[model samples]
Target: MSRILVVDDERNVLTSFQHLLGKKGHEVLTAKSGEQALSLLGSNSPDLILMDIRMAGLSGLETFRQAKAIVPKVPVIMMTAYGTTDTAIEAMKLGAFEYTLKPFDIPKLTALIERALAMGQLMRTPVTYGAADADARAQRIIGKSSKMIEVYKLIGQVAPSNVTVLIRGESGTGKELVARAIYHHSQRAERPFIAVNCAAIPETLLESELFGYEKGAFTGAVARKPGKFEQASGGTILLDEVGDMSPSTQAKVLRVLQEGTCERLGGHETIRVDVRLLAATNQDLEALIRDRRFREDLYYRLHVVTITVPSLRERKEDIPLLAEYFLKRYSRELQKSGMRLSPEALERLSAYEWPGNVRELENCIKQAMVLGQGDVLMPEHLRLGQSSAVQLRSAPESLNAVRELARQHLEQAPGSAHQHLIEQVEAQLILEALMQTQGNLAQAAKLLGITRPTLREKISKYRIQRRVHLNQREG
Candidate 1:
């Protein structure tokens, strides 16, 4: 029997957890807030903590941070609702064992708890990834941000199994890199790794491309062509941008997933292939399912263990590391030794919302390296597109833009729009200033055209924690 701590702001949820776990013959402790959870930790060391992501005061993420400091070895499992999945992912990056959506399945929850408890013991042991073999497997993947660390952990946990994985992120977020990472770490590393971009291939040929073709199947079909599925037999096949696949193709893919067999376009023989399928897409598949653009059955077939890659903006703390990595990479490729990014360049890079994600950042660094004259890349050398330029505008222009945005939001929204819009704008401006100044309150205030005291008060009012360190002077 294990002692579990259940924390949530909802009294009913606390009661339900107590009743459920009590019947399992486990000792359960309950807390209503983060403070209460921390207080409980002083006297009782539970084997696991199950907590809600959103609470009244201290958020589950903040609470998880504190709890880890208090009891580092104890595993924490966060419970989140629909829209708060990203926050729960962030919590996972901060050392939470795992997260489950609210109204979770009882069987899944029980299985997760059992696994967490068993994994807790393994986590306590000192594990190092310094071996040359392990380093070689993960060399392409960079970023030490908590979020990326979480991704790394998940990859390590899931790569060995032949599980269907759905990698979701915006374009340029390096979903393919992640897919490759899993392939490299898996037992099938020696096998061929084939990648097919579903969107890039026309729907007319996608079926043939994936499932192969028999001789004389169509015009210009002179010979038998083994499709990607056949080519990747005993290996991994990554279906990139899979959401764009046609319904017929989706059905075929679903058939392949379900039956593990596919027939060539004109052949009657069913080809049995042992291939691991990995699907990636930037689109909201659930929304697509609602609109009937995507097949819900196929979505379920591929979403066995979903991994949502964090956008670059969401993990801004990793900007410097990524920038430096790109710098060295491009420098060596271009044969320009001793290339580096300046502090101002890094600060701008960090402050910019990378809509194109990591892919855009890499291109910007490469462009700067190509055009930049000196060894050190400066702010002027970087071109982050029109969006970034707008983001870097003078305070007055930014304020005016925010005012217009708030006006539009108010016009469209109902109920307390004015107050909400004002608070939103205020918080955004303060957060941007802090990000640009790398959490230097005085510099941020100066940039925002506000007094330090006023900025401090605003930070407190908004409960903003300056965490990005992009503006640190480059060494």
Candidate 2:
């Protein structure tokens, strides 16, 4: 459960929030004024702070600054019965999670509170490579394989430095966990660690989401908002699936790397950002660059240091260990005791190739925990279904593999060496993605790290000999 601190000068506001948030399973601590909130911070580092902007004494802005100094990672959401656009913008620039006019819409307020709590938890949660600590809350990497050990070592070596890191791995290979581990062990451990799923966010809003926006920036943009970079200043920001970013977003991100500044959409003023940027991707960036999809400069900037996580198939020896860890974790979470994986179940888990990697294993275990009865979880409980296991796509080719192919292509046609390399690699990558997705254009596009139109254009540009139906949307 999350602990929330609600601060307001009015007694009714404090009591209402305390009672309402309490009903939602959050431990709500309320204070009458900014001074009281600051005092509360002395002893408690709440996951989220909800404060009124117009508090008596201290003031909400001052309290927010002080609260950040006290617990730098905690997220604060400011509310005011008397809110102006300037006040909201100021609060956001000061690193408030959100700013809202008071007389709260209960549902919207509750949703906002949940989001802040989730963001705060993501920032502060510990990521370990070994067994769970005494407190079961720590997320463990759950492998002793040499591959994983190397990954752990890389995380350690790179965590202390301020270099931008590129984590390469298949989807669900625990890249986010690696990013979190780096953050937790780094010098900026006390500061926030914001994780943005670049692939999940739509291309249109990705820029505004990263650099925020000015009021009247768009039709619906009623007020100015500060972006995650601002909120994570002096901290770290992990851009998950950074490969899927659009060219415009990529250019903006490159600017942030070259110069520590970004301008919000429809705004003239440049905002300086101080963040340790970490990017993770499953895409073959070399191929993306070849296809002219991913920016070459941005790729170079991100790949200053690279950590490649082993896919589950590559580290099959860790299957039993990971399965057991998940069993215990889900047992505790689901409140089911004496739940053990059967010998047959262990054999089954070990035999099957995990296409989705660690995340799929965790989900499989959690599902089994809910399905299996008595003490032992049987093989049948696993239901290691045919669909995922049957579609055994090859791992993404390494940059070295691409370079080797480039050498062969250059030897063949020195006059158009680069073009030959791009054609061969892009065509091959597109074919593989199409075959993997059974010729579904959308999925192929996603797998190829480009848009559907771009993918269609490449299909024609390469004049791929293998014809596939383009109309099918689902793969």
Candidate 3:
């Protein structure tokens, strides 16, 4: 049994933690605020501290800094109710033992506690790459598929270091999620996690957004701003969609990454920043690098730790659990109590091809939940495009034919410019998801969490109408 400290401003939460740990046969301590928690840590230090991020006086992050001063070896687990991208990332950067969202699974938490204790026991042993303090991982990525298992093993090997990580995969393959998982599992899991999407902001403003600007640096620069890098000092920064960044901006990014510092767009001071870099992209960066679009040096820097997320279709076995997860999430979001997927609906979803990946899958379920009139989701309510019945039947049953069919499906149909761009993105996502899922719809949807009807809609919407035929050997 390990001694645990539960810190929170809310009395109910503190009590809940005490009860949970006590029931698990562990000695537990409770603190109402950061000040109280530190005082308790003066002489009696618990093996682990589970602290709430938001509090009345000194915040959890502040308390974490102080507690580590007393016992540098003791691990801290940060919990947050508000699942903001920045906060979650920040906690992970700060060397937190783990970052658990509110309303987390009890069983998962129990397992995590055991792992932490196990890791504590193993600390005396020399830690190494792919084998360092594996028990300290914030979240256990549970998967048995060859690809997913490889990803886990790789992360365990790299998580404790300060290496720059580049996560590549199709959109909805959880590239950023994988980066966050890495941050939390690393030695810097207790610092800050700051992320910026390179594609969302306009090109003209991206430079200022990343390097920050002085109060009057630009016409609309009313107040001095700190960039993501500055905010993420002593932690990690996830440069998402790195492939979309402009050449000019990419050069600047490369400089900061290589030199470990940056100067604001108009500022003179070369402010130094110590941060671990994590980059993600759905585009073919190697091609971009070859074309001189992305800097080769920067590419190599971020490539220090490369991870590819498995598409949903690739892991068919995880679909049922994923479906259940999304159903519960959508149910709570829509205020529909005890909503579920019917057995037939589940079976149908398992049969369809999800081109949109996980993001599309979640959207389909949300739309279905809203359109659904009952507690259960139905095939019709999903609005997925399943107009590929003809194409599927006509497909040839050869390896070469399957690849050719997939390729033809991605080839653009005749369309106007606006439709063409949408079609292009849609085609790309579908193809990538299919590749990752290994041509399995159930796994793809679960990977994407889309209903059969909805994924069917996109396949038709993009006119991915190439026919395919598979032998008994094909999955």
Candidate 4:
């Protein structure tokens, strides 16, 4: 029988849990507060913990963190009321096994407890991957946030297996990095790692890119060329933005996953390739399935193992660490050594919602490194356009100041003064939004309170040019 620890501030809750768990032929230990829970943890060494989120003394989250430090592998199931649901989610990101809402069903709670204990046992078992490979893979993913720690653990668990992996996250959440980390730690680590962006390539060329055609097979087929599948033989191939694949391409990919063979474009020869498939997407595949946009079969095939990377907003505790990492990196690259972020700047970063995730933060730091005057990065040096708009809205003086500047510009211009002022304000807002969104036109449009088509039309009329970066163009 497994041993369980139940922690709650209420006496009735402790008694009820003990009675429920004891009836199941398992040992139960009870604690009324976080202090008692921690004190019992070392001596009791329970297989699972059911703790409340809100306690009088030390909070449940703090107690969980401390408990994990003492016994990292033990599973913790947080119990929270409706008001503390968000805190429960934060606990889950911080490595909690799972969470159950207050007034949870008895059967469901018992089942959850069983699953958590089983998972704890599995985690404690030795992994097949070499320690060195695991360490190296962990180093490539740079974040100590609870969410990131969960991701690292998932990578270690899934890399040794040959199953297909689907990485789902927002556009700037480093899906590609997760794929690479998996490949680096896998059994096929010595083999090549090829990445193809499905959304970036045209539908017409996607088939040819995945399955090469023979010489003289088509207009551009002057030489026999191998596709990404053949090129990534005995290795891993990351299909970035796989949700953007066309129906025909999806059919072919499904065939490859099923039969381990694919036919080249305009050729009858069926080529067999051994490659581990990793797919990444910022889209909702289920919604696409419901809409008949993405193939259900292909989705199931690629989703043998799914890893959802947390967005920057979901893991805000790591903002300072990520900011510092980017600061040191960009500083070294830009030859501006000894640069650091100020406490106020870090606070501002933590407060802002990072819609663009880690990539946007990196860009902001790089921009600060280039444009900032002093060694220490300040709040003024960071350009959080959308977030800055919030601050400006809160303080009417800032908006008035901008309006005053526009008025002055209008007064100074002679021909088409109003038109000139409007153009200037629009252009500046467009640029700032573009910068914050890393030149993503769709996101910029959303920030500017306009539709994409309208934004594109205005960009053409204003003759606006934006430099393309990694996430600059919309899928």
The TM-score values for the models, in the order shown, are: 0.54, 0.78, 0.53, 0.54
The lDDT values for all models are 0.78, 0.82, 0.69, 0.78
Decide which is better by lDDT, 3 or 4: 4
What are the per-residue Cα lDDT tens digits for candidate 3 across 1-475? 5799989999998888888887665789999999999999997878888888888999888888888787655667777774442453355445565666687688788777775665443332222222323454222343456787788787777788898888988776667667777776788765656567899988999988788777578897644556767756787788899999998888878887778878887789888889888899989998998898888877887798789987767776655655665676555435666878888777777776665555556666765665467787777766554322233334466556656545565574433545555566667777655555555554444435444445566666666545321111212
**Predicted structure with the largest lDDT when compared to the true one:** 2
Per residue, candidate 4 scores C-alpha lDDT tens digits across 1-475 of 6789899999999899888877665789999999999999778788888999999999999998898777766878889886786677567545576678888789789788877876555434332222323431133456677777788888988999889999999878889878877876688765546678999999988998888666677896654556778766777789999999999999999998999999888789888888899999999999999999999989899998899999999989888878876776555446678999899999999998877788778777876775577789999988885332345655789889988987787678867877787888898777776776667775566556555666776776666774434244652
Q: Candidate 2, residues 222-304: lDDT per residue as tens digits?
A: 67788888877788999999999999999999999999999988899988988999999999999999999999999999999
TM-score leaderboard ranking? 2, 4, 1, 3
Residue range 1-475, candidate 1, lDDT tens digits: 6799999999999999898877665789999999999999999998899999999998888999899788876878899887787787566545566678888889799888877776454333322221323332134566777778888888888889999999999888889878877877787765546678999988999999888677689996655556778756777789999999999889989988999998889989888888999999999999999999999999999999988889999889888978877777656445567999888888999898887788778767876765567799889888777323334343587778767887788788778787788788789878877775557665565446454555666777788864444332221
Question: Candidate 4: which stretches are off by over 4 Å?
Answer: 1-139, 386-475
Candidate 1 Cα errors over 4 Å, as ranges? 1-139, 386-475
Q: Which candidate wins on TM-score?
A: 2
**Where is the poorest 10-residue window by lDDT in model 3?**
466-475
**Least accurate 10 contiguous residues by lDDT in model 2:** 386-395
Candidate RMSDs in order? 26.2, 13.9, 15.5, 26.5
Global CA lDDT computed for model 4: 0.78
